[model samples]
Target chain A: MLKIEEYRQIIDEQIQMLGGMKRPEGLYDPVRYILSLGGKRLRPVLCLASASLFGEYSAALMPALGIEVFHNFTLLHDDIMDQSDVRRNHPTVHKKWDNNTAILSGDAMLIKAYELISKSPVGVLPQVLEVFNKTAIEVCEGQQFDMEFEKTSDVTEEGYLDMIRLKTAVLIGGSMKIGGILGGGSLRDCALLYKFGLDIGMAFQLQDDWLDVFGDQETFGKKIGSDILNNKKTFLLISALNRLEKASKKELLHWINRKEYEAHEKINAVTRLFQEAGVSEVLIQKRDDYFTRSLENLGKINGDHEMKQEIENFVHKLMARSR
Target chain B: MLKIEEYRQIIDEQIQMLGGMKRPEGLYDPVRYILSLGGKRLRPVLCLASASLFGEYSAALMPALGIEVFHNFTLLHDDIMDQSDVRRNHPTVHKKWDNNTAILSGDAMLIKAYELISKSPVGVLPQVLEVFNKTAIEVCEGQQFDMEFEKTSDVTEEGYLDMIRLKTAVLIGGSMKIGGILGGGSLRDCALLYKFGLDIGMAFQLQDDWLDVFGDQETFGKKIGSDILNNKKTFLLISALNRLEKASKKELLHWINRKEYEAHEKINAVTRLFQEAGVSEVLIQKRDDYFTRSLENLGKINGDHEMKQEIENFVHKLMARSR
Candidate 1:
């Protein structure tokens, strides 16, 4: 199996190479600054690992780098839309500069992603571009759905799942699928890998939701019950709302309606209500189901047992992390 | 020469195809609505005409359509950023819907542009993608330069030209160049075609600046001297700032510095100063020079005499238009 460190190094180097030109003074600096505040590099790593499962991982580097650039491009724009103050503990591009700068820098980053991907080996470029185009549109669709949900009242769990699947999971799936295509995998196998990644992504997002409410303060890196405070329609909250008795539903609505409440007290109230309503357990089961489904899909791939085991071990390590 | 109506129909149909079945409810409707409101469709028409100079104009439809979609996408986003209220005598997308929806829909339109370009016939997809990527990035660079100029004091005419070339010219160049490639033109001919289109685009933008200040009210179909009222960095203003006597420069600065002023008075003062400083004539001469240069470049392309004559006639017709 490929070491994560190796993939990280390649991605970092490629990103630097992508940003290695003298732009008009203020133009490209924001791109550099935003890319410098790093995260897990999870998407590109998935691309490389999926490619390695079929052929030389190095073959996937260019496309994987494209995925990383595309992800960061989305982040830059999303930050502006969400009015986020910080990203990776640094001021967001929009916060650091201005909305117009963020918009232009994000636009450039997106174009740069296309440029990098178009540089893929000739044999793979067409199919890779097709998949990339679809994924890009789906990501935009997902974002639209998300924004709609903020103004809507009738959002279902299924709708939210589909939205996240497009917004977050498909890109992760696309990362691996593009890698698989470049690695000479069969179309069927590539589809399976995409599904596997998507399932894991769903589980991963569920875990994030869980942590928002129940995580340990030191390890979670966010305050407990943050979603409740923000009126976020997480799986747990929506499920709880759907399943609660009339009295419990009213209580939840009351808390949700309040613009100001003591943080600790509200957190405790919501936590207790969630516990009584079995929302926490339900979310855990849903997360496990996705994880299990992802593993099952992974098992369908024809590869050496040792290679599969190595990937499974890596997955286990990722799942074990608290933050 | 291909009929402009034939090109317009193809582009309109192709654009409709881009907004497929799964479009988000409110988000994409405004984009489609705005697009349907219609304009001259000049960019796509130029693309087809350039392509036809070498072979069948129909061969260039997909890339031409891609250029049109991409252009409208930029307009959608730009309207949001500029807070403009009208487009083609109708309320702009952001005015009709909200900023967030406009932004998301504009994003979807951009993805749709990529999709349209990616699905171009197999032989030309690589070159199309390459040109599209470069043009897209240059557009962003232009937008960034435009935003940066808002905060900076030393915006020279050269700086403004560079910015407009990126922001407005390169996409037009890409449109023609991609069309030429699809029409089986030689690489050298394609390069010349692109240069021709770029020069024409520069002149077109300059004409726009002139119209903003001096165009006939009935013919312009927009508020006259609107750019002056908004204190935009048009070529005339920048030239006037550079060439004016110290007293006039100081007075101009006073008007520029005052954020609140009577619209009519400010427009009269700026126009008077620009005329006095010979800024208007300078801009007119620059526009004519670009127009002539573009024609010269068009003349240099190695093509059949009849084809060259056809394009030259079309350019004359375009230059003769008042708006």
Candidate 2:
């Protein structure tokens, strides 16, 4: 079993190599800056780990790095679209620079990702590129779905699930699947690993929804119930809207309708209503269900027992974390 | 060399194939709408011609289609960034749909370009991907430079040339080069073809600039002097600024500095001064220089005399056209 630290080092090194090129004066700097402001490297790590399940992880590092580049490229553009002020506790690329720079730099990042993937040895390049292309298209599909959700009403739970699956889960699933393919895993094993990642990603996102309202403020690394303040349509809120009695519905609408209510007070009232309506318990149950399904899928993959245990332990650690 | 109509048919067919996939609901329809509002398909034609100079023109159609997709992808996002209302006499994608949709759809177009390139046989995929990637990054870099120009007042003629080279010329050059490479041209021949396309692209853009200000109202196919009205820094305008005496400089500044003015009066006055100062003649000379240089490079390429003549005739026709 490979050490987590070893995987982390490979990702960082590959990132450095990918970025080390003759970029235009102002263009490449922003790309380097965004890559430098690193996150968990979760996607690439999954790629490496999945690859390691069948073959040398080192062989997968470049392709895994490609996934990382693609992920960051999406983030750079997403920040501009979302008008986000900060990312990873730093000013977003668009915030610090201008939107045009952000847009162009993000464009370069996508190109760079393809460049990295194209550098993979000839044998695996075609398969790696195919998976990469599909995942890339799916990510864009997810983004479009997300944008549509903003102007829409009556979004079904199924629709929301599909949206998140396309937007978030599929990339994670694809990353693992790419690793499996690159590592010479059987097609069935690759498919199973992909499913495992998808389920885990779904569970992870639901947990994120849970944390928005119910998480410990200190440990969660953000204020609790912030979603209610912003009128975000989380699973709990959507379920509560659907299931609440007439009186509770009216009360919930009042809080949502008010444009200038106190954030904390509105959140508190919304949390209370959500709890009373059993939305919180329902979301928790759904999260647990997906998490269990993810574990089941993971259990079915035929890999070294020791490697499997290591991956399971890592995933457990991820699930147990508060933030 | 192939007949122009033959090249056009191949390009049209390839474009149809590239755009054949069903766009997920609410996502990419507007992008498809904008792309379907066709233009002259000149870039792809050049690509096919350049390739046909060495081998079968049909071999270059998919690669040429890749360039077209990449070009449209840039247009989709650039429309959003520039807040453009119309493109090709139709509503820009962002205007027709929304900014987010345009952004995502443009992204999908970019990914689709990769998908198309990856479809090339394994023997050529790596080189095709490499050139494609480099060209893509350069396009973004050029766009970034253009954006930077908007905020800065000290843009030089050299700087403007460099920006347009990235933004416009490299893609055209790369399209031809990719075609040449895929058509089994030697590396040296591919390099010469790229130079030829690049020089021709520069001349093409210079002509575009000239037409923006001085083109006949009916023949130009767009609003005359629109660049002046929007204060765009074109080669003639920049040269006028550089060469103007004190009085002319002040007059030019007045027109540029004014927040609002009669469109006709301002355009007429600016065009008059541009001509009086010989900026137009200088620009025309520069444009011709590029055209001559492009032909010179084309002459250096080792190919059949008849094939070379066919391509030369096509270039002449392109240069001679009004719109």
**Number of the top-ranking candidate, with DockQ as the measure:** 1
What digit string (tens of lDDT, one per residue) describes model 2 on residues A205-226? 8888988888878888877887
Residues B1-323 of candidate 2 have per-residue lDDT tens digits of 35766887777766665555764756667656766888878788877777777788776776678788889999888887888999988889878777767777788888988887787678887888888888888888888788778777688888888999999999889988888888889999999989998998899888989989978778677889899999898998888888889899889989999988899999999999898789888888989999999999999998757767877887787777664
Give the top-scoring candidate (lDDT): 2
**TM of chain B, each:** 0.94, 0.95
Query: How does residue B299 of candidate 1 score in lDDT?
Result: 87
Best by TM-score: 1
Candidate 1 on B273-312: residue-level lDDT in tens? 9888998788889999999999999989987677678767
In every candidate, how many clashes are there? 0, 0
Q: Please, what is the TM-score per model?
A: 0.95, 0.94
| Model 1 chain B poorest ten-residue lDDT run | B18-27
Q: Write the per-residue lDDT of candidate 1 for residues A190-289, one digit (tens) a residue.
A: 9998898899888888888888997877877777777878788888887788778999988988888888889888888887888878988998888889
